[model samples]
Target: MHSQNNDKKIIKKFNESESLVINEFDKSGIISFAQKDVSNSFLRGTSNDFIEESTLYWTMKFNKYANDFFKKLTSDKYNFNQGMLKVFKNDMYEENNSKNYLLINSADDIKEMTNCHLIPILKNIIHAPKEDMGLLAESLVHMTLLKRKFSIDQEETVGGAIVVVIISKSDGFIWKEKKQYYSNESNKHLEYVNYYKSQ
Candidate 1:
């Protein structure tokens, strides 16, 4: 309950701290790609809008399990099961008409899994440094393919991956936006050394 003059000073300071500036020189770019033929592997990947929507809609319902998966991968601390993921199309997570849910299985079911399992790759991408995102995405996908003994150049198998990296101002400003797509179908692998490579 300070004087109005103090409140004015606080307001002024807050406004000065709120710096959002965008001009014609600003640009935004999305770098992403995916492998071809998604039916051959026990894993699946998606990125960009699909991932964004899922992150927003699922929130904790999905993130808690994803965090567990990440912990298991990064550290052997959690005894979480690393098994195939299954997607159910039903509206099971209908809290206020929200449709988002995930179910996990035991580790014993890993080998016989025939469906395209969803990896905790999104958690990795979400927590990755902004500059390392592109290479990280490609590297993770390539590594997964290597695990299946798939060629990086041939046999577009059922295993696929997509990673979306968007470059923009750290303060959240946009003037121009661009998207570049790379995939096995196009014979292009999505690899960028830095944030500005796509820009």
Candidate 2:
């Protein structure tokens, strides 16, 4: 979280830019001027409108922070080997209970994913189907950060890690610790990275 002074600075910057306006929303919290558009829209006045407005507002407000954090995190090791981003679909069935996983390992796929905008990536994860494992989308984003945090020597044991994001239907979104392990038979190591969800 940013300090009160920093928050004031951010507000001032936004005020100067005139691209958006932010103000407290009747003691609830600060809301963006863009939210007024949603409030007046015809989406049955549902919470979905609020969610979409909030997501867009915050994404716009904090996108630069996320990008700067990414840059600071990855500037030192541009050539490090990165783990593959994987998506899994969990089918809660009796007979065909096998978990199917999608391996996003192609060079083009990897490049596009790594370079894409963060907001859409997060929105996709947040709105993904129950079986689609959109919750795990964040793991892919964290892989870039983790690769820079941990040393190459430490990663050798895992041969590379697979980042998976998991979202629970009823519990809302939460972050969890990264899991790392090595497979002796395959001579590979895997780091399962995740965001730290508050308890």
Candidate 3:
């Protein structure tokens, strides 16, 4: 029994260390995007200017599996099959129970939603390896989109938006902007992209 318990503890420790390493790598990708310049204008101006001037801010690497998972999460098929729409409606209702809930359409909207609402939602939804790092990256993507005045029809679609921003390994840093609409049938609304250059 003692030996079995020791073995279990050792395995658990190893798993925890592996999780930490993966989380670090995921965080490094976000840091890389944050450090790199989004445009020549960004280089000349202060950080605040870069935030204000750039339509699409920066791109970061995402784990391919996580990216794919996020895409599926936004798909109409997933929402329908999982009954996520009902869940989303409930979540929004709960959020607005005390006050009016408005569609996220601007930077101010995003700031208000994220600071008060979105963080907890992401934390609840994103449960996997490097969950905290993933939450931060997703939050940044949402903030960038809202800052650029991209319309996110519903809060539930935020995961899909994050997938749209995920940078592939082959593509180095690049800068581009375009409107993204959710391909999923459930939420056919204008999606925002800050810098989709990498994708």
Candidate 4:
């Protein structure tokens, strides 16, 4: 959705930073990714094949973003798993169902959904107006976060929790960017606070 000049500028910036730029376009919006920004630790035990690795990275990024968002905001100890993230998008947001929750309805035919769970997303995307991609992305991420939290508190697996979402509206412009070290320190401090508060 960007102008040619803007695209050029993006490419130039990535070139300068020695980062691999990946641009994916869908009806919802464009996803621009920099390979370097993705953490290698998140790729642990994942496939080595390029396509498989990228798919895992994308999924992990969603988990990472959600985890990063809640790094210090809560006392709950849990993680957002990939299954919960999938349910958030596929079941709640109707990603794999009717696709009606999409910001743009350009498909030839929307899939007919018989039994939808209809779990409410953090931000109501039922009739969201399309203007800013960053807001849309953030809302989706938050929805995943909420789902993962529920899974951790109630679900059997891991007795827990993951999802990452990112957006860069402009060059060097990260949407709600939280530095890695800052998040780490905040999480540690919160651990101490949670211990003392519990005591």
Q: Pick the candidate with the highest lDDT.
A: 1
TM-score, every prediction: 0.21, 0.19, 0.19, 0.21
lDDT, each prediction: 0.36, 0.33, 0.35, 0.33
The per-prediction tally of clashing pairs is 5, 6, 2, 13
lDDT of 1 by residue, 1-199 (tens): 0122432343344323222212223332222234422211223333222332333344444545654555555455645444422122112223222311221111112212311233243344455765465555455566656645665565544355444344545513222222433343543333442245757
Better of 1 and 3 by TM-score: 1
- The CA lDDT at 152 in model 2 is 64
Compared with the true structure, what per-residue lDDT tens digits does model 3 show for residues 55-121? 1221111123434565577687754545675466456445533232221122233234323432343
TM-score of 4: 0.21
RMSD of 1: 23.0
Model 2 TM: 0.19
Best by TM-score: 1
Q: Show where candidate 2 strays beyond 4 Å.
A: 1-119, 131-138, 141-146, 149-199
